[model samples]
Target: MKSQGGHFNKIIINRILATFLLMFVAIGIAMFLGIPNPETLLLIVLVMITSIFGMESGIVSIVMLVLYVMYFYSAEHSFLLYNRGTELAKVIVTALCSLICLLFCSLVIHKRLSKR
Candidate 1:
């Protein structure tokens, strides 16, 4: 039983990493396409990912959120470049929206899984 649980955990970790990478790829595509609100697109994608992948999506969402914020801070010269309070506010809002979406997605996924 213990080994089974451990194996399950490992699978979840792998799934999270896979999902995170996919999210990054999608972000890259959005950036290239000049999406007016990549953050919103990201949140929508995250929710869909969670809905499809189940609970592991929460971890994926968190990793993506952190990396997204860091990219904004480090990119220096990009749409996400944040040099003022207003710019920073956009990041904050994106983070909050991601968190909310993750929570709702998790709950929905959990309920669905429990039914199985």
Candidate 2:
């Protein structure tokens, strides 16, 4: 447990780290679900989370993304999945919706934190 909640820098750093960790977890889940180019999406997610959170999370997430990409591409078996046009469109739509929701939640949190 961290007791230095009053320190703004620490709070931001912690939030970033947590966001990155979440991004990696999300990428893993997506991989399990047969998503393709998980590394690229992971990088994007890391950027989004870092933008919503901070630099530390973005940097760390990118690091993990790089590692994953290396392993993913080097593996004899495919780490990414391929989909048809319709499926790709569907995935894009779902990703857009999810990003909207994430932004909405981030806004709410930002508002609440600003009020404090």
Candidate 3:
């Protein structure tokens, strides 16, 4: 599906790398503004994974979500929540972060294609 008009692998690789870079930038911004939570780290990683590869990208997104939840549940006193990661608030926050990552990559691809 990626070869009809242009090279897909390069686009994907570029997007993935750019996505990670954006995450670090986003995280750095959040940190500078005082997010004060480990969830920020998980969020940056999760968002990067979800965005870099689409929905069917792989099992990575699911696995990471589970782990984040697990850690949230076991810890009970994280800066983001109090008792594991099952809280609705935390899930929503994480999802929003992922969406941002998705948007960033989407824009990059869009710009590249548009330039052609």
Q: lDDT at 17 for candidate 3?
A: 64
Which pairs of residues clash in candidate 3, taking residues 3 or more apart in a chain or in different chains?
72-84, 72-85, 73-84, 73-85, 76-83
The 0-to-1 C-alpha lDDT of every candidate, in the order given, reads 0.74, 0.60, 0.54
For model 2, the superposed segments whose C-alpha errors exceed 4 Å read 1-6, 76-116
Candidate 2 per-residue lDDT, tens place, 1-116, comes to 55565687778767866876787687778679877666556746765775677555555665566555544544353434423455445445544544454555556766777999
Which digits, one per residue and each the tens of the lDDT, describe model 3 over residues 5-86? 4786776666556555654565456457765454656555655565556533313443444345434444463535455344
Best by lDDT: 1
- True-structure lDDT of candidate 3: 0.54
| TM-score, cand. 1 | 0.76
For each of the candidates, the C-alpha root-mean-square deviation to the true structure, in angstroms, is 3.3, 7.8, 7.6
lDDT tens digits, residue span 48-95, model 1: 888877657666776676566546544484645567876677777777
lDDT of candidate 1 vs native?
0.74
Estimate the lDDT of model 2: 0.60
| Model 3: residues with Cα > 4 Å off, grouped in runs | 1-36, 46-59, 74-86
- After aligning candidate 3 to the native by TM-score, how far in Å is the CA of 51 from where it should be? 6.8
